[model samples]
Target: MIPIRSAGPADVPVILSLVRELAAFEREPDAVTATEAMLADALFATPPAAEALIAERDGEVAGFALFFHNFSTWTGRRGLYLEDLYVTPAARGAGVGTALLRHLAGIAVDRGCARFEWSVLDWNADAIAFYRAMGAVGMEEWTVQRVDGAALTRLAGR
Candidate 1:
């Protein structure tokens, strides 16, 4: 049985490890620039940038979901964007992933968020199916634009 609950500072190491694992799984391990210290400060410092939920099974940490509040421009209402979620291979099939998602949804509802959103890669069919089964609709018409690292530096320098 997996228990899901909010993460605290003590879980930062595990969370960062899981993030690296996920990046490696996506074949983009080199792209992960976040360090343990970065996660620690972002998750535990004053006015935190995000929050996390962890899944534990039989006293062992199994998975985690990290999220932060966002806003929809059109509706002008708050939203919850699940930045990362992962269940370790050893714990998959034990309801860890679903539990984390449902947990996040509860938070979203409690906070009156207009939406709970996350992006799964187009190749991740299993995840897409799971989300669809949970009544999540893909806004296929929308394209995601991002600026990171050098682009962010250049954009800000403009």
Candidate 2:
């Protein structure tokens, strides 16, 4: 069984490295702006904004899953939202990704989450297939919208 555990302060550096690897794998090698300090604060701060799980294979770090909770007014309960899941190239086909996903699903069930959800890049057929194989269905009716950087500042009237 792949060992999955909660990430601690000591795992900050490795987690950041894995995040960079994920960014590169997503074809955005220069998109990562997260630093160890930023990650640590986000993961370990008072009422942490997010949480991370570390998966290990053969006593080595295999991948990580970073997630957070969101409220669903419709369901009147919280939902689990996976922000990122990355399994190293070497660990790709070794069930590491499956194990991490299964772990998160269990967490969602244990926490009474109304739903467990995440978005995958359309170009990543492999990931799409993987998620489909795990019983995930695409919400074709919904399209995600985002506003950040200068636009966010302007929207906030700052």
Residues 63-107 of candidate 1 have per-residue lDDT tens digits of 999999999998789999999999999998889988888889999
Supply candidate 2's per-residue lDDT for 9: 100
The alpha-carbon RMSD values of the candidates against the true structure, listed in the order shown, are 1.2, 0.6
The TM-score leader among the candidates is: 2
Candidate 1, overall lDDT?
0.91
Distance from true location, Cα of 11 in model 1, Å: 0.8
lDDT of 1 at 67: 97
**Residues forming the 10-long window of minimal summed lDDT in candidate 1:** 1-10
Best by lDDT: 2
Candidates in order, TM-scores: namely: 0.95, 0.98
lDDT score at residue 148, model 2, on the 0-100 scale: 97
What global local distance difference test value does model 2 have? 0.97
- Give the lDDT of residue 113 in candidate 1: 94
